[model samples]
Target: MTTIPEIARAAGVSTATVDRVLNRRTPVRESTSRRVLDAAFSLGYVTSSDVERLSESEPLTLAFLLPRGTNPYLALVNHRAHAFVERNRRDARVKSYFIDGFDPDELARSIRHFARRADGVIFMAIDHPKVRAATDEIVASGKQAITFISDISTSRRHAYVGIDNFAAGRTAALILGRFNGGREGRVALIAASRIYRAHMEREVGFLGLVEERFPGLSVSATREGHDDRDENYQHTRRLLDKHPDIIGLYNVGGSSDGIGRALRESGRAQDITFVGHGLTRDTRAMLADGTMDAVITQDPDALFEAAVLAATKGTPPVVTAELYLSENMPPE
Candidate 1:
């Protein structure tokens, strides 16, 4: 097998430089690092066991800052992270913290607290200046900062590991429109908040598609659910009362349970074509009962693995959005 010394010689760098680039213990010039990696790959110098041994010597400590809520998707993400750490025990350790609310100052403090402790940090970011500044500072301090599920565009996050949310929105719109089948009534949009970039982007895509393709279907003004079941229930109830001809509903964020409850209470469960995000237990039941028409989802397991890989390997995995329906729901 080829060796690091041979790769260093071929790349015209010293063995120490090659080691530093491979281990990522210290910063190296981007050009030099690329050259060394290219040489190593060309010579097939590093084996999987060699990489595993290196990881065992310097195990990664990754901290995940997730939202504190009953949102099934976030719970799934937390579960997947722990599972990954257990499966790769020698390579990494994951510690997850749940931020209680949408206070950017509190979130910033949490980020700073983990800055010096973990090798990398991942979070579902709110698109606020304070949070963005904190993320950029973490990246500048030589720790990887990754955004998962949602992104803060202004920050210097190493990478984002989730589906293309705008595309997911467009896909949802396509499904909703088809399911409604030439209906000429209002479609309501519900979201967690405009502060979440992912939800905002999804809302934009959904609105654009509706305006372009479903002109006959008017859209109600967006209502913020804050991913709260009660809040979403109120929003749905209000929309139903105001728009008696509502034909479709698209929930761009969480709280499918509240939406389903409102629909059932109003005796509109079968009348409205509902499309929501996340394939949680609530959504699965709703799908089976004909309350939710389809669910737009991304694999939480894939997201956790991508975040880990990005933190340790400097390459992020791409996860695509999945469409789940009653017939195709994956078994728990």
Candidate 2:
């Protein structure tokens, strides 16, 4: 971490002066404060408060491009991000737009639109040539572009503010494999879509770990639901019908409610081990009712905060995944 003394030294100012600027305990000249802020920002140590004091003119305009959906987790992210902006009205001007996550042409166009309107752009990216080209073009135009939730490959996005999906996949596998009592037959994997880099990575990690550690558990079927409840329900029912050997089910994306309903109606909810991502109300209820065995999740508020930091300060915080079970579910 960059310390105050380091920022003060880089700015050729006293530590007391830096403190005064950061805390607003006393008035410091705008030029001196800008110098300190520049030093702190260069060192990847600028905080929201530091950016708060960096400018007295127009605030920095940032845009968040999210997916339009009823997925509770994404909705929570959108809510928290807007709430963050409301709280930091003096430091940032945040505009959030919901776009289709699977439409590359629309996503790419939205990126360019935000690039023209905002100082920074943060979005859930679909990994496609069109999106990658747009990312490059936006960055070349001298604006910050950060990828949220899902990222694009070969893009110029400054930072990604989400947990490691591959590791989350491996964690899901590890939990499900152990929960099967060493008598695994097959595992089914479901994702939102493989077009998002995060889903693809998670699928790879889950399959790799299941094969590496649990030899008996073969991944027999993979399906895409696009995080839609009805689609996930239909897919899950079909999977259960076709794959009687499935001893474990791993949801690499959202819409766990549909999966739960399918398993419960199939009268085999307790026979198979189920693991999924996110800690939304649906998952929480499923976990309590024994439909879900475990939830591998990251905090939504923490993720939004990291996204803001990455967008404004160029320093993204690491958001670690948390495991939730019925017995150890967090207090709301």
Candidate 3:
């Protein structure tokens, strides 16, 4: 069994500091508190009194408003969130709501509803004025409104728990440009929607990098796939037909499968360099088969854990995007 003293020693802090972090009885430096919590988590440290106190008090209700789709990444997020809630059942209650389609009004309604009931709400925000207003209202109501995956910059969300999307885009551009070997051809950009701040930022970064580093490569006007496989397929087909000279492709959202399918069917899978986001079963297969060259991904578990910590501890840890290739793909 891990004790307070063990955790204090592991964190290189005094036992009193560990106690204060665990009990929340005193204000400890953020760095020290993080160290204590990290040590406790690493050691599986727990106290009988803490469990009893939590079981006696009202559980913190956390609401996760995720996008509804067949997107494997989002499905993984939903699954892991439920698992997290079950693991912390004694301390918190987590409810996940999937918003169908891209209806800002519907998403706003869901946000408003949860704001009234949940102690904290984390959502994949649509960058819209109405959604931003609802998020602002939720924050004003003293509830924690944290945005994940995508964020609404104009909103008053407490914090964003995800990777730096702009940097992810730049990284993708760097890989795609290098793989093409300074080939003078157009690069097609696909995304779910420009209304998603994350996608927009990625597009901005990709274009900026291509302009600065790969002057020989030009980017096509981004096509919105709405995160739908069929939509992405159609868009990709249209792009390939209109611009037969396109040598590279980058998908800033879900639907890597669609993009891969289009390339495979057109017999261009081996010719075009493909880069995308997320490392799911489909993307892993694509990588193995040479349809996708690289994937920019962030850990869903890390993202959810950060959001939960932000809700309970008032500080969300930063997550960085990692580039995955066939050789470096994560184990299933």
Candidate 4:
């Protein structure tokens, strides 16, 4: 393995400069940083990531990016995340920046702004190329990148803190298959967008598992609801109108209320069994009302802790997930 000293010598910089660039302690001129990075890359000199303690010396800041979720289920995540940050603030060892929603250009601007301000960033945005590129620039600017919920495409983010989406998809298929008593029927999948890696992988995993395990169940159609209630309503209505045989629906994103409404309006509520994602207030109510069968869930508190740990400590996270049903929930 090529040593930092060797790279420093080759790049015509001191070993201290190489160390500073690697640890992101101080900003070097862009040309010097590039030369050192290129030399390290060429020599395959990967930096060690042993967690260095905070030293009780310098304070830190972490930036967070997440889509604005008005739905009670997801709102809980945001609220709890903010509280968690506050708890960490008493020592003045941590600070936070929250980006409300996702707009490619706005998020990009936010990333650029935070790159200079934060020691680390925890991103929950979609996996768009532009988002990834902006995150990469943040990394290049020396901030540790921690991605939560969805993995971005172009950035070499430091850690991922959420459920293994493929496994979640497989779990969904298993639950749905058992719900149907192994009797296959047409299934409809509605997602927020293809830009979210977790959502896309869940759909892929669901289809893969169903095809491999329960070959009789067929997918009727897939639609992008963009995680909007009105859009979900319209898409659900269209899908039901076009495919009256659809026996199951999986909502892998926000706001299943619209879909529930569409099914009720179509007089097909009893005809279809719905399995959705998350444990939002509305979804929990739907499960209670028997509008939805079950929900695949990740604990919001655990997710927030894991995200913060990964942001500050730069370690891989293990997600603890659960399958929720009406019988399993606490009485309201």
Candidate 5:
């Protein structure tokens, strides 16, 4: 007999999507819906017959703690999650919460608050031990905790939903190398911080690929951007002065919006091939203007869905590694 798992595999979707499709609970694309129905027919799978018979189920209250700020990306996450919850409320009764920024104390307080009422909590990965302890407390109190954007303590969260930092890094190196066609020159890297696991992992992957796959390129120096554009710009400016031969650049974190400005002012923009992570509005515009060559992005909807699913459904989502180019994505 074909299970929901089988249907999901056949349909190239998550198991939750399978459940939604079968129950007539959520809208699936026509072509995909047809494929799923056909697969079910072939395998003798009946939609929702068994789900309807399940004895006990609880409507989940899922809370989302995200970076509190005016950033469009973060705002989009909140909007998408709220929309999902609203759409699924009749059946699942899902609820979510948002926290501004990376304040550990505020996050801990929010976790404790949601733990009182929620079945699950989804938090942006803040690597502080206190934050991990708070999540551990939530899990111990019988509520699931899921990590989003970055991975935190494994023992605290139910699952992690984000890109493979190592793979993202390797992608940066690959793009830069191919963009340069493996010509010999120093490459500069700017990142949010060496302590951030996401940025560190990317650097590790990029360095490994550069050493093994593109031996012609040498990583000259790395600067910690601290997620601040001004600092990133200053650091990049210093690096440019110190390493005049730098022909390639990769930013794993804050894109040093100022770095681009400085490079343009110095008339070195055309001399360097730059690749960065994230598809912020500014970065998108930069790509359009030829200031950036490529961007590594984690799907916003996918990331939010993964966080929600991990909390409500206890499922770990598969993170997709995507490289966006100007030609592929016009300025938005």
Candidate 6:
């Protein structure tokens, strides 16, 4: 299938301009819009107005909610989802949001707010009771609520479309524990937020394995970065200052650039074994420069495919965590 980037190339326009024309979110100059439409039609990415317009009984709307940030992983998935909907415009209206997933009340309100327009919701959830109640209500209202990445297991979401986070965590622990070469020292955990079920599970898995297998490694600290680069930098700097002898560092969530920076700035990048999640461009750089030792990540394309499959009630694509090291890094 032709992609938005391809359409942009054919039209001699930027992808953002292609998005403006396709999604109709902003006004485009008549000439530019015409060029984009012509390119799209030629590339089979567009339909005629009659075909594009929804019928009177049109009620198929899918909502995908994600945490608001420039987190490399989330940004990549968001772009993929938008392009998917753009390519499949005949199916249903797609409404996606970058929300404060950590804010339980706000997230719950957003879920309820979609009742008027959305037939389904796919979101990364905060494992909170309010969010669970909201999911149940959405499911009860005859709409689907699917969890992805972070899950609310107790919630009435229709399905979860992601990897086994606990296993992913264990994998990280295994890598860190083994890679340390029998040197026992304090390990620190840096997370986006424990409110996120994925981060909590990963932390638990890491801690559990460290306790069970690496009895000599003690968990020195677990700091919440809130997935903010600056916040992670600050927290990591403080953690390093407090525990100068720290040996292993595990990042269970995003904003790893900050953690990497902190370690390097503290002159501890090579001294500490750092493992993180999400194999984005940034992480690839870290691994190449020997800043990060290993990364535990799932396929991003599979993630987008699985969410859409869950929305359509199809067999969701299988997602599994893969480890990445400098030697095996994919070509940029």
Off by over 4 Å in 3: 1-57
**RMSD in angstroms, all models?**
5.5, 8.3, 8.7, 8.7, 10.2, 12.1
For model 2, the superposed segments whose C-alpha errors exceed 4 Å read: 1-57
State TM-scores per candidate: 0.84, 0.83, 0.83, 0.78, 0.73, 0.80
Worst 10 residues of 2 by lDDT: 50-59
Tens digits of per-residue lDDT for model 4, 22-102: 777864665787777777767777532221231122445777666664445566677777777677543223444545455
| Model 4 lDDT, residue 77, Cα | 78
| lDDT (tens digit, per residue) of candidate 5 on 119-175 | 777776667777788888988988878877777755567898888888999999999
Can you give the lDDT of residue 214 in candidate 4?
Answer: 83
| Structural RMSD, model 6 | 12.1
Give the poorly placed runs of model 5, Cα more than 4 Å off: 1-59, 68-72, 87-110, 330-332
Candidate with the greatest TM-score versus the true structure = 1
Q: How many backbone clashes does candidate 3 have?
A: 0
Tell me the deviation in Å of residue 237 in model 2: 0.5
| TM-score-based ranking | 1, 2, 3, 6, 4, 5
Off by over 4 Å in 1: 1-55
Model 2 clash pairs are none
In model 3, residue pairs whose N, Cα or C atoms come closer than 3 Å (at least 3 residues apart or on different chains), thus clashing, are none
